[model samples]
Target: MEYFVHFLLAILLTALSYFVGSRIISDGVAIWQALIIGLSVVSLGALTEALGAPIWFIVLVPFPVGMLLLFLFLHEPLYTWFFTYLITLALYSVFHVIMSYFFSFHSLIPAWRLS
Candidate 1:
């Protein structure tokens, strides 16, 4: 049950980050495309985690995949891609902190505990 809750929270945060990031960046990446990129990042992260990767590796895995997916799907230019990725990361971190501190949510990344 706790796992399910964390899973749902992770999904929600991932999607929300991309949605908000795209809107903030105004990179013209559609909402649906943003959603796909977000979900893909989460899915890839989860897969690496499930494969028994190290904590650091699991944490690091999603970034490149996300940037690649962003470029491949949205064709965003270099600066936009970097800025969008930065925004996504920043938003996710902020949301994660809020959820963890205020709502007692689990870490979005494995082997991490904010509580």
Candidate 2:
């Protein structure tokens, strides 16, 4: 159940971040594109967690996958896609902090698991 909530939140966050990032880069991301990126991120994160990956690994592994997804899905130029990826990550970190501290939840990006 917790993982389910986290997955849902991650999808929404990713979509919102895509919107904001697109605006920042003066590029555009379709709604479906944003959702696809979000799904890719969360799915990869969940897979890493299930594999007993270390916290650092879990957090770091998803970055490239997401960036690639952005390029593949949006077909944006380097500057636009790269910056959008960076901005999305930045916002994800902020939301992760909020969710972790305020909500007392596990990390949003899928790190260590509870026993």
Candidate 3:
């Protein structure tokens, strides 16, 4: 059940990110392009994480790089992609944390809890 909820959250976040990017950048970006950007962002983060970079680097570096790629190659502006990516990451993190707490909490003791 929790996994399903998280999956849905991911889908929602991707859609929201695409919408925001399209709105801020231009209506020209196709749905496929937006989805590619979102997926690429996730892939970059995962690869970086697997390479042993700190988790913070995943959020900070990949977003800008992804936005730049989208802008330079895809013709979208940095403002649009950047803002949309940030919003998506923020929402995903928040929801993931909340769900982690709800589903993984082992005890009422705050300090003893683990995600």
Candidate 4:
């Protein structure tokens, strides 16, 4: 059940990322392209986690995926994609760190603790 939930969550997160990325890019980006990029990012994250890297490292996976997609589809310059990728990575890393910290903290609280 737990694994199923995680799988579902991964799917949802990937979809959400794709939606947001596509919307932001907005100039002829196809849904399938977005989905592919999103899935790649999520797969990288999963692989990193499986390899026993810290959660923070998993958060960095999206940037390269996004950059690759942008360079491939948007005709964007590689340097532009690289810069945006770094910014996206930093933003995601902060978000992941904050969410993980709060989640772990809440889990430690007696009311939220699972045995």
Candidate 5:
């Protein structure tokens, strides 16, 4: 259940990142296009996680994949895609760090995580 919820959240975050990058940081893309890009980029990480991969290793799959997909999915130049992906990656990192800092839950053992 934890993995399931995490995957859902990751999908939403991917869409949000695409939306922000294309719509706000650069020219707007179709919502459906963003969804496609997000789905393509995050699928590998989702698969790795589902296979019980280490968290640190799972963290590494999405960056280059997302950048590659961004360039492929959008008609924009590579620099635009790269820069926007960096923005998205930075935002994702900040969100993850902030959530980890405040999050107290741990596999149904909340206090166990603190130690």
Candidate 6:
């Protein structure tokens, strides 16, 4: 359904983030590898979401795991973790802005918070 569409879009954007981050900062992280890592992280997020986790948990928890994954997978330095996360957020926001123009469904606009 709609959620599935959003999920796929999110994974795609995640891949885009990895591509951007690798190119701009971590020169060693390949596009192919980025696609794999991005897909894996988003998949983990989706799994956690299905377990009744909160929005913050869904948005935030996978970050450290992602950082670890980058280190392990790309042999990237700890410093590049910042750029990786930063690029993900930036690119995700860009994706949201564009999608918002076409669809009323605003996934990036925080909904149903714990508080």
Note the Cα lDDT for every prediction shown: 0.76, 0.74, 0.54, 0.52, 0.64, 0.67
Candidate 1 global TM-score: 0.83
Which whole-number lDDT from 0 to 100 does residue 65 have in model 4? 68
In TM-score terms, candidate 2 sits at 0.81
Q: Which rank order by lDDT, best down to worst? A: 1, 2, 6, 5, 3, 4
* lDDT (10s digit) by residue, model 2, range 1-115: 9768877887778777776776677656777888887788778877887899887988887778778877776677897777877887788777777777777656465553332
Candidate 5 ranges beyond 4 A from true positions: 52-56, 104-115
1-115, model 4: which lDDT tens digit per residue?
9655655455444444444544453443466765666567666766776788765566665556666775686556566555545544454444345434655322111122222
Report lDDT (Cα) of residue 25, candidate 1: 70
Local error of candidate 1 at residue 52 (angstroms): 1.7
Error of 2 at 9 (Å): 1.4
Which regions in candidate 4 have their CA more than 4 angstroms from the true location? 77-115
Highest TM-score among the candidates is held by which one? 1
Best by lDDT: 1
**Alpha-carbon TM-score of each model against the true structure:** 0.83, 0.81, 0.52, 0.54, 0.70, 0.71
RMSD of each: 1.9, 3.1, 6.7, 6.6, 4.9, 3.8
Off by over 4 Å in 1: none
Question: For residue 39, what is the lDDT in candidate 3?
Answer: 63
lDDT per residue for candidate 5 within 1-115, as digits (tens), equals 9866755665666767777777656775677777776676667766776788887666676667767667766678777777777777666555555544676323211122442
Error of 1 at 104 (Å): 2.5
- Model 3 has an lDDT value of 0.54
Give the per-residue lDDT digits (tens) of candidate 1, residues 17-44. 8778767876556777777877788788
